[model samples]
Target chain A: MMVPATSAAPQSGAHDKVPLLELEHLQMLFPARAAAFGGKRGHVHAVDDVSLALAEGETLGLVGESGCGKTTLARCAVRLLAPTAGKVRFRGADITSLGPRAMRPYRKHMQIVFQDPQGSLNPRKRVRQIIGAALELSAGGSGDDRLRMLLDQVGLNPEHANRFPHEFSGGQRQRIGVARALAVDPQLIVLDEPVSALDVSIQAQVVNLLDDLQDEFGLSYIFVAHDLSVVRHVSDRIAVMYLGKVVELSPAEELYRRPVHPYTLGLLGSIPIPDPVVSRSRPRQLPRGELPSPIDPPAGCRFHTRCPGATDICREVEPPLTLYPGGHEAACHHPLNVSSSDIAGAVRSPAASRSSGSVVPVPPGG
Target chain B: MTLRDTGTGHVPVNESAVGVLDVPAEPYAAGAATYRLALRRLRHNHRAIVFGSLFVLVVVLCLLAPVYARYIAHTGPNVQHITEVLDINGKSVDVVSLTGVPVGPTWHSRFFLGADADGRDLAVRLLYGGRTSLAIGVMATAITIVLATVLGLVAGYYGKWTDGVISRVFDIVWAYPALLLAIALGVSLATGGISIGPVQINSGSILIPTLVIGIVYVPYVARPIRGEVLALREREFVESARALGFSNFRIMASEILPNLTSTLIVFVPLQLAHSIILEAALSFLGAGVQPPAASWGTLLASGAPLFNVAPYLTLAPATMLVITCLGINVFGDGLREALDPRATVRTGY
Candidate 1:
């Protein structure tokens, strides 16, 4: 019921500057044969019209359920997966259709961190070899000092380089993955749920390490994850996706406080509050049905079937993201309009109500 | 075991003598420490060990054929004429020297096998034949492995035009009957139609069969290797290597090649067996190793006519061939199973 915080608009002068990485109407479809009792051959909408932008030194959080196309979008952003349609511009140059040979130079500037730390690393290669592989590929640095510096940058001992991946802990392996990405001194890193496979305690350490490294290198990150809390912590701007489509996007504080899109609200509601009393006091709005199959998604809004305020209009036509008074945007026919006072009144627990001031609501339309 | 360290957190330390990291090493746990593990696995596979040992013994014998032939049959001393040494009374003397003339009534020796119908020691002939067989197998297999590795890696890694061209070429080669090509080449060699530089070597010699076998089997070796390359080329590590800016060649050679070691190790022995059997088959058909040189196949061929009278001739060479091939195959199977990721770890007794 809490009103979300409004995101401050960027100064008019700064609006003219180009984004470091930009994807316009990106779509990636995977062709799959129809089921045995099925109608027609269909394509899995792995990524559907996902458009996002990352400015210099910005971390854009892309959160979604599994099969929601976050990873696919991340890959497309880095040109690992070619977009079925739309443009991917980096530094004002369109690189969406760049050939393999042409994309080679751009690879040095952009890199990706895979989700599964174990699967991401080459089991046959030693830690040193894995790290050195990137360095050797990009011709990053010469001599032992730079190599040692790369290792040290990731908080790993340079001496431990000789060990194979099997010899490293999950956290350490992920660090090696990060080290490999950073080998070429890349400007942007598409971190595809880098810490999801690690232990809960280890996740914090990795996140902190990434934060430290980002600060040190002044690097922009396209952080993809399903964990909203983690996304909130790491991201400057957050994009909530469902069924291969972005439902909402806003600054971290504003998105959490005023999640106008029903899917985003459901996502926020699903996060377990540490305080039992506050969690119990808040009204839970769990969506009834499972996600629709991407092969043939719903007629209009992909989330309409699960949207609390879904109507005929939602089913008939997909709503494009409409900018609110703040810089926050949400693609919802019927958006939430909870007031700060209402949120304060609704809270049963004094402890919960005390923290309600920090929650600011984003307006429905610009 | 703590949950943190049990499933995913266990890190293997590289304890190489030289602390140089990134150097490729076998995945077996280091030192005599894990000897127990390998020993246990090997022990459970009794047939494998027995067969592997036998194969090793055969290879060792083939390598030392010159020494054995010299000492056992006195063949090295007189390659032209092998006469059974006689005493003053004109009766054949039983030379006690391991390298002395063959004096036994039958072609049989303790382990040297036997002599041929022409008074040539069968044991010596077998050893000499082994020398030829092993040389051809090793040389031909090396060529196959090298050619297949390069072509397969290039085709699989690069895909598109390179893959298309290599695949089509292999398909064309494969569609042509292998045995027919071998026979055609063998016939060409027989007619002195094919010449290498100044050498006017006869087609019936070992060289012809070796060349025929090598050329025909190149596709066989390349196909399997290509399949492996195709699967591995798309692996995430390969992508990661590319992301790191690794040149295509380095990725193929250093990153990919090491992974295919177990496959190569398993295939080499099988290839050797195949070459040997094929050579013997060709010789039996009168298209392989000519007389005087004395291949097991030629010996077998000679013995076939005398089988009703002296079955020992055919039985002797055939048995040697069967044992050698069986041993090689068993060892190769053992190696394949050992390299298998699904193989259960046995605690050696």
Candidate 2:
């Protein structure tokens, strides 16, 4: 399955093997309200048609703002929630409709670290019981020796284990959560905004702990986050989602270097640069139009209503994901060409484009 | 914000970013179970300790009533020493004063708390009455809460139709005024006793009042337990339990139930108070505890007419009842404060 690519990264080696996990056409629609008469029932399309894959030991970053269905999609991926329709394949085995009993053995391989650290663990439980529970469940029973080893591995003292979650700081709690997930000896872990709830100073600590653990355990991760800088710091490949659809999928460097989708360019423009000098000189251009309701989405591309380069053709028919240089794919009608005349062509100056960095040669082929 | 204008060199270049920082443990770390922590808190509370000790003392007296009666009093609770022959300070003189009833505390011969209208030692009878009242309260609470907890957990966890059916039943039970419903049930069931397929209960059986009181207070305990369970069902920890492949039973028992210790502990003393009062009410109406049993309610009923004569007869049980209920209530309030984990939660997290 190894497919040689023009990208400088070595992740192309993953192409030869079956992905650790793959989702095909996932859809999750929640019932909003029942119709009064014989009318059709209304639904909130939380997660519409979407597909993705995760290679072994690879981190795929799923980036989107809140209400864009990142959490729901993650839930569907791990079978925490059954998708309205889709195939969730784990190493080429379909597990989408597995019953709770059938899902038990698979749970040891797939674990989720939720967004809120305090809420993820039972406050009534002691830290030892919290982490010890996973150890016991996955391995029948575990001694304090293994427990202490796990605590130390996560940069925590064994003495802290007997304390309750309330006594711990936010970063320490997240470390305990990581210890819990690792106790199960999982293959893939879904990190749902793992640092979004932490203070900025502590967020880096947790993120680094997660990165180090992934290498030590050879674990695959679906790191979902709303922060682009954080995602770029971690992900091998980035998939930008909008209104329950993947608008662009590309290698991390290539996507930032040549963001083919107008939506991606607008998102990049929003990240604040620490150098006040550069920020003062940068032009201010926000994305236009309101997000439509998921219940009654606009025709054709869901992003067309807000896309800066959206044309009437984008409004007439939905465009399939089109291939671009360096294996990048963007679903759009009038895609940006490159850095020279790229990103809305009219508002952006080549000088400002140069300021954004990521200037690279046009990739040879898809 | 870390991403600067290309030349700042502050942020990592995509591939290499965010270095590891190990956070050390606090200087003093202690992990204790909520129960042990609550116990430590209770020990620190002077009011709870004093009142809790008083309440325990009363309960111990009630349990050892027979010991206080046979070995110490030298007279059975049913014995009649009507004229009350007594040797006061080595002088053979009856202790009955101007009232023509056996009276005055002899201290010796064990008429310590004095004698009631029945010519029985009032002290011994008070202990026996306290024992009966304690039994009825505790037994009724045990029956009511066990039923309520099971119903509440099932209804709250499996919401739609199961919740509907159980809640409707709880509603119907809740609609009635507690004492009135208790009286009605007590009279109907205890009038001629009850006989099922293989079991038969006599009208005098203590189960009559216990059953009536237990049935009456079901809604009080069940409604709160159900409400707590409903909230807990939405907690992320509960969902995590399910995610970890714990069965519904494990999730409810191990995850949700342990978190409800404060609620359940708070409920017990209140339920005990209610059960005692309800049993007293039923016994006063002659539909509870029957004739031979000397419950606080029965003794009070018999002594009310004697309010003009032997005042101690009426005053003794009424005063004991008030003290017992008050001690329980005050101690229960302190327990609520002591057991509250939220009060102990460290802030600035």
When only the first chain is scored, the TM-scores of the models are 0.87, 0.86
lDDT of 1 at B326: 97
What are the TM values for chain B, all candidates?
0.75, 0.84
Worst ten in a row by lDDT for model 2 chain B:
B12-21
Query: Candidate 1 on A1-366: residue-level lDDT in tens?
Result: 111122232311134789889888788999988778856889999988777778888888899888899988998898887899888999989999987788888998999998877667776677767776577555656456777888777777789877667666677778889988998889999999998887675666677678767877888888999968887777788888888877787788788887777888788889878799999999878776898899988976678888777777678766666555555666665667544343333312111111112222332331
How accurate locally, in lDDT, is each candidate?
Answer: 0.71, 0.76
What's the TM-score of each model vs. the native? 0.81, 0.83
Local lDDT at B311 for model 1: 66
lDDT of 2 by residue, A1-366 (tens): 011112222343266778899888788898878778887878888887777888888888898877788889998988989999878999988999999899998888899888888888887788888887788767635888889888888878787777787677777788788888888889999998999988665666577678777878888889999857677767788888788777777787777787777778877777778799998888645578666888776777778888766666567666566544455666665666543333222231111111122222222231
Query: Candidate 1 chain A, which ten residues in sequence have the lowest lDDT sum?
Result: A347-356
User: Residues B1-349, candidate 2, lDDT per residue (tens digit)?
Assistant: 2333234355432222313223343433333455676677677778877877887888898889888888899887788776766766777645454465656456775788676655778888888988899999999999898888888888988889999999999889888898888888899988878888788888889998998899788878888898999998987777777777888898888888877767888889988988998888788888888866788888888777766866777788888778778878888887887666454653211
